[model samples]
Target: MTGISKLLMTLGVIIFVVGFLMQFISLGKLPGDILVKKGNTTFYFPIVTSILISIILSAIFYFIGRFR
Candidate 1:
């Protein structure tokens, strides 16, 4: 397989694993996440979750790059 195909497959597997874990994990409700409610309206944002995911992915890529 080509480089692009390998990258795509890796991404697909990562997405599948994340989706499966999300079914059993309450990541969206993590602390530092924002939740605003007004009368009949509500808004939510997972800032902490995003940052944590970013850091985790960064480390993963860093290690992968080092190995490569």
Candidate 2:
């Protein structure tokens, strides 16, 4: 890769990391008159969902690359 491409890639990665971390810095419930609420919630597993998506996508790419 060229130097410019490498620099852009590094910047992209830094931005992604910062954006992801900022999510936790929020005071979920501030002096808001009313906090967010949930009702009749079903199973909502984010970790599992992300894991499954990653696994499936990786497997798909692996198979596709096998043909090349």
Candidate 3:
């Protein structure tokens, strides 16, 4: 397959694996995430989760680039 196709396939597999693992792992509740509750309002932000995913994706892309 071409480079783009290969990259896309790799990403698809990564996404599938992450989705599958999410069922067993609760990344949303990580310690540093923000949660707010008011009388009738609630707000949540997965800041830690976002950072963790960013780091993981960065590492994955770095390896993928190295191998390309």
Best by TM-score: 3
Better of 1 and 3 by lDDT: 3
Q: After superposition, which runs of candidate 1 have C-alpha atoms over 4 Å from their true positions?
A: none
Worst lDDT 10-window in candidate 3: 21-30
TM-score of 3: 0.83
**TM agreement with the true structure for every prediction:** 0.68, 0.36, 0.83
Worst 10 residues of 1 by lDDT: 59-68
**Which is the better candidate, 1 or 2, if ranked by lDDT?**
1
Whole-model lDDT for model 1 versus the true structure?
A: 0.85
Between candidates 2 and 3, the one scoring higher on lDDT is: 3
lDDT of 1 by residue, 1-68 (tens): 59778778777987898789889988778989999999999999989999999997998678666755
Which pairs of residues clash in candidate 2, taking residues 3 or more apart in a chain or in different chains?
Answer: none
| Top candidate when judged by lDDT against the true structure | 3
Whichever of 2 and 3 has more TM-score, that candidate is: 3
Q: What lDDT is reached at residue 56 by model 3? A: 89
Task: Point out where model 3 deviates above 4 Å.
Answer: none
Candidate 3 lDDT:
0.92
